[model samples]
Target: MNDIGGSDTIKPAAEAGRVTLPEQGLWKNLGQADGLESAAQAWTPLMFGQLDCAEAVCVFLVDPEGGRLRATSHWPRTRMPAGALIGAAEAAMENNRGVVRGGVGDGGQLTGGLVSVATPLVVDGIVLGAVGAEILPQDQTDLRVEMRRLQWGAAWMRDVLRRDASMADKRRYSNAIEALNSVVNVAEQKDIATATRSATTALATRFDCDRVTIGFQRFFRTRVSAISHSAQFNKQMNLVRLLGAAMDEAIDQRGVVIWPETQSDDPRATHRHQKLAQAQAVGHIMTTPLYSRGHFIGAVTFERPTDQPFSQDEIEILEAVSTVLAPVLDEKRRNDRWLLSKLGESLGGHFIRLAGPGYLGRKALLVCVAALTAFFWFTMGEDRIAADAVVEGAVQRTIAASADGFIAESFARAGDVVSKDAVLVRLDDRELTLERLRLLTELQRGQIEYDRALAARDRAETQVRRSQIDQIEAQINLIDKQIERTELVSPYEGIITSGDLSQSIGAAVARGEALLTVTPIDAYRVTLRVDERRIADVVEGQTGTLVVTSLPDTSFPFAVRKITPVAEYADGATSFRVEAELTDGFDNILPGMEGVGKIDVTEARLIAIWTRPMVDWMRLWAWRWLSLD
Candidate 1:
């Protein structure tokens, strides 16, 4: 006997009670029963469950329509050969009892089992299916008890099969209704392809199909997107492009399209088309609508490779998913629109701020203030009036050389303050001295001659001798006068301000050439120019103060001496020359030193401050207009 768990064969029949039947056992017709007509139709899980048994159990049912055996269920102890059960069922139905089998083989290895039993399933007096049971030694059991149990199970399975067969018609009717509802929901919610895809994917997965696709009308074009598929389908493969025209027509008409097999379609359909059945072997299709705002966005589709089709519950769930997905798609569109609007507003607002009135107004105000300040400061500040001024100088005698001769010596040069008789320049007087000596000798001789002639007193001779003596005295006097004119000298006590030619040792000087100039150093004055407009304000004896650039802060006081009637033109500025002599207190005063003297034009009120610049400007304009050069 084989081990209980490890055995590849069925348990021994001797382990349970066994009953022998006669060579011929009676058969019952199941098709003849009432309500059995509708039960024999399609495959059902209850039939499959009963067929699962040890040692090559076989079950054949009427397929829930009573027309033919729609499916056969089998489980074999050892590996069952492919198609063996189906072929055995067809063969054993000819006799329709339990047929014992022999070892089946082509030549060497045995292919048949130790025992075989054939049973036929009948419903409504019609043959529906047949079952063949093959047994090994380990599978022998109490045939009477097991066979009785199988009969009871088959009765129960008939009810289950009846129920399963009716479900398909109900499911198909309900699915059509659900697809219509999904279309209505999508139309009401105004969602497009997104809703379609979501509904189709969920529905396809629930039904376990090879694929689901959502096809839609895109203008004259048809578009398709896959939503869900069985794991057997290639994830990354692209679909054939021959279905676009059919889908397009179906979607535009708002109707369902079914492609039972894709290979029937033309091979060269243009634009986003698919080949239905051939390569990818899509076996079935069901599609529904997608709508936006009552207008079509697309459709939802489902597919399968084998015999399975979508159930009612799956379609109802998809309708619900479509209803939910519609709003989500609308919300996504709304968010995108809102974001674009916000961006446009932000950019427009920035431009408005840049060109707005506030910016221009502030800029204009700044420019106005700047111009006003500039005009008020530089031009107005420079138009000012200074105090009246006076300057004075003393006139002095000019001394000159009396003769043309070499300067043999000198007694003075520049800056030497001198007295009335100071010798300033000396020409060569040697000849004059010698001539003077000769004149002196001649004068002495003439004097002796005059005295001798006076002493002799010869009355007649006295007259002639007196005439001779007078002539000799006249010659001596002429020599003395010539000697005096050769000496160049200063005529008064003054500071040397002009000539100083003490180095003319052998050079000649002309008669009346000024060898040096001497002005009084201790007798100085200040001179000033009064603008013509302000000259009327000046008085003859107004006290003036002088300041020199060399000693900038110092002031020398002097009384106004005289206002010269002459108007001096100084670099196109016309002013009346006013002179003021220094007081007796300045012993060190000097002439020809540059200074500005201020004469009191008398104190005036603040009104004068305003009028002063105006008065000066009027004078300037008048002078310029008159071409006063």
Candidate 2:
């Protein structure tokens, strides 16, 4: 015997009261039966007659149509088999193997001296049904032998069931192929309306439907597009609206819907379908949704007489046809539209997906982009031209060396505040002092000679002496003025903007050499290096703001005072010099401070303000290389 729980199990046949029949005779008798039920009925009794001590025998066959197991035949036809025998049969079928229970009574307790044996009738790994027998065996040996006999007899049942199943499968396959061919033929039409109309008509004729209608989803609603047996019909008609509503119901559920639904089908909302059926006086109606690329696209509805509800096989075939026709129909519909219409529809579909639920991350990104675009498009801002700027002085005065001498003393350096007449630099004044002393001595001697000449009353001598004294006096005065020039001083009360003489004490200085630069403390101007591309937008009297590097937290308002015509080239770029005067906020501002300045030109859109540079560059590039003939 093999494993009994889930595999074939058998034992030697008992010798006592076993009526053996020839294999040839048994096969011939089984063949004589007309069908599975008849064969089972004949084989059940034969097996019971051969096995000794058998109480009752029954055969269960799987219904090919429903795929359910039911009792086909039983021996001693006066009464039903015991519960234990039926249980064994079902167990064998469920387990797909032979089962043997010994000493089990009707209640499934080991209190009786009876034994039940069941063997499943399997073909091609499919459990067709089972055969069960209750026997009053003499002993364990007899029970095993009865089980072996039952297993052997199950072969006939397996054959019968296999034959029936094969024939049914062949018929379903042939029907499915024929239905597919019909759908393919209909799809040969070039346009959606024609194809849909032909498809509905063909389906109605082939499936014996009274009417057939097709509808497609448009703008989230179902619209009837075609009807069988009619070339054109009013879409606004009550009947057509009802048909569309029914199609919508099916599409919403994303499954096939049938009126007068079967008990085995899942429950679905079908109010529209019911209403349509009642208004149209159609007894049997079925609607199945069409899908393409995993998206619901449309639906097809079929109607028939009350007596002819659709069969499972027909329903399956129709579903197959729908699968084949959906993509073809959808493609044809798309191709039939005008180019502009196609583009609009495509965009509309994408917009729908974007606006609908789901795609949270993408939706957020789209919202942000749209917000930015709207802000740039509709918002107005100052059209300002940005340029590099440096704080300068309104009037710069350079204090230079007055005489050629060594630098002797320094009173001020760069960045120092000073008043008018403040000594900024001093050259060596020793040489001027010596020359003045010599001239003074000569003047005294000449004066003494003049007095002597006057006392002697010599007129010629006196005149000569007087002339020499006057010459010496004039030279002394010249030396005194030269001494004064050696000391450099600030021209006004201002800051020393440049030049440091303290570090260069004792260094040689020349006459008129720039030793220090000074500018009024309260007067400041800003010079901006405006790019040539943007220079045209800048002009005198245009007010702007300036932020210097030294005082970046504060901004000084300025008005453009001048724009130089000359262009300056530096660091591989061209710019123009623009001079602007600070209008206010001069406190803490100093010359030579550099930062960025923006000159306001006019009011403009924010997009233009931000993208002006790039747009200008692109325009220039196109003009240079993409010039048209």
Candidate 3:
């Protein structure tokens, strides 16, 4: 054979190649074909003539009804193209691009050495078919040129494919609109059974299916609601069960499930689908999940004869119909229910969402709330009353000035610790000293007069002088006692809780004036300002704990010693003074330290403990406003 790439070769310059008279006649023949199959047969030979050294050629086109690729025409009319050429065409269609394969043998020998090139015919972003050719081995440039010619030759084929696709789309759209109209009519039915039955029957007739069944998910199980062509059927029937199982299978996968699945489809669990098909002796079956408000609510299953399997276009149309029908059907089902049933179902759906897995954060929060409610409802806790508390000395003493004088000195002040007999305050004693000296001089003079009268033998005069001397002596003793009482001192080891005489040194003070106040150390009492609303719960001998602001980390245990019967009003609230002595001694505690206290009254539920105040207030207000008759 002469080298196909030599000068004898026909090289068409343009991408589509110049159409000679013979080519024009061939194009006319291609146009005359009634369908894509006949046109492919006429076009294959023309394409083969445009390229050099072509051993065999084939044209493949997709079957719109079946959504499958088949060889429409091939060269060498006696036999089919090589398996390698067919594989290249399938691959190009699958990949929606051009594919090339070269054959080579060992030792650089040309063993059946041929190059195959396949180019997919795509139009409007859709792969419609592929054209493949086998030729003798050629250089890379020549191979590229051949591929370009093959692509250009597919242009007419693209136009034909586009037209078919547009027609199919229009038909599909019309069918979808018709299906939607039927669904709208179904929705008009007031009862769920009627609507579901109408929907199934309409789908069966529209798709030319032998039977159609609709199932709704209830209690985590699929229940067949309606079957096509049957006004009434036994739910216990084996056929109904099988149909429900198929629907459940599709629903569980949350996708479309088809028996006799295509090779291009994703692998799925179809054990139930397979069983259903085999048991019913059905040739084909398809089930698609139904969603309402973006939730999987049910499924629809279609059964057809063995001769006609569901095509891609039909499956898409079914999906669209189901999407539009789900919510409508669901609404009908809802309206047909009893009032109580509607509520139960509405709550049931929410409960299912709460109980199921997913939404971890929301579930956890719900669990916490439930647990807290249960704890407060069923568990008992200490029924304690909370109140503002203050630390006070158990026994307090006030030191008053015993004599009129000035505050001379202060040894200790408020918050200071002092031992017994500690000099706390002093007053001015200069005037007392002067009075004592003058009285002593007058007593001495009276003694001298009495001695002079006795020497002159005057008894009456002596008696009078003796009386004046006694009176002067008494005055001197009184002055001396007043001077000694000027100094103030603590009667016991305690803290100076109130007086601060250190700033008033030398200040004049009247007798019996309060110079300082002292409280014994290591003895403290907690005074709780219990709200009047809760004072009824307070009683002597009740135990409680106190936490002072200054010593927050430390808690002092105390028992109520006294509950003042009178209520004191202050700060827009009324409270009763409740005195409690610390049962547990603490050295760090000081008088006047403030804190909060909780008084344990009795055991009660935590809910009651927290809501008691509010409840009491409400009760009181109601009693005041609604006490008539």
Candidate 2 Cα deviation (angstroms), residue 598: 48
Best by lDDT: 2
C-alpha lDDT values of all predictions: 0.54, 0.83, 0.82
lDDT by residue (tens digit), candidate 1, 1-629: 11112333332235342221111210112233234332321112222223333245555655555555534544433455235555556665656544435433454233434444445554445455665554433333434333444445455434444554476568767666665655554444344444445545556655676666655454556566445533233333455244444456446556444455234344223122235455566666555555566556555556676576545466454554444444444444444455677686556544424754567779899799678655544443222223444322375556676766678777777667778777776678787778778767776876676677678876555666566667766776776776776665666667777666766667887877767766765566666777776677777777767776655666777777677788778767788877777774554356556756667655444444455778677657655544232
Give the root-mean-square deviation of each candidate in angstroms: 63.1, 45.5, 43.3
What TM-score do all the candidates reach, one by one? 0.33, 0.43, 0.39
RMSD of 3: 43.3
* Backbone clashes under 3 angstroms, per model: 39, 0, 2
Candidate 3, residues 1-629: lDDT per residue as tens digits? 02211222234546545222257666776777666777777777677777765767788888879988788887645457777888898899889888887664555444446878899988878788899988774565667788888888888777766766777799788768976786886967879998899888988998899999999998888999999999999999988889888888888888888888767547667788888888899889999888886568889999999999998778878888887888888788767778997676556534524745569798899999889978898888898888999898888999998987777778888889999998787777888888888888888888899999999989889878987988898888888888877777788999988988778888878878887889989778889999988899888999999999999899989999999898899899999999998997577788988999999999988978887878887667654544311
Candidate 3 lDDT for residue 254: 87
Alpha carbon lDDT of residue 603, candidate 3?
Answer: 91
lDDT pick, better of 2 and 3: 2
Clashing pairs in 3: 406-427, 408-426
Q: What is the lDDT of residue 504 in candidate 3?
A: 88
- Give the poorly placed runs of model 3, Cα more than 4 Å off: 1-377, 450-467
Pairwise TM-score winner, candidates 1 and 2? 2
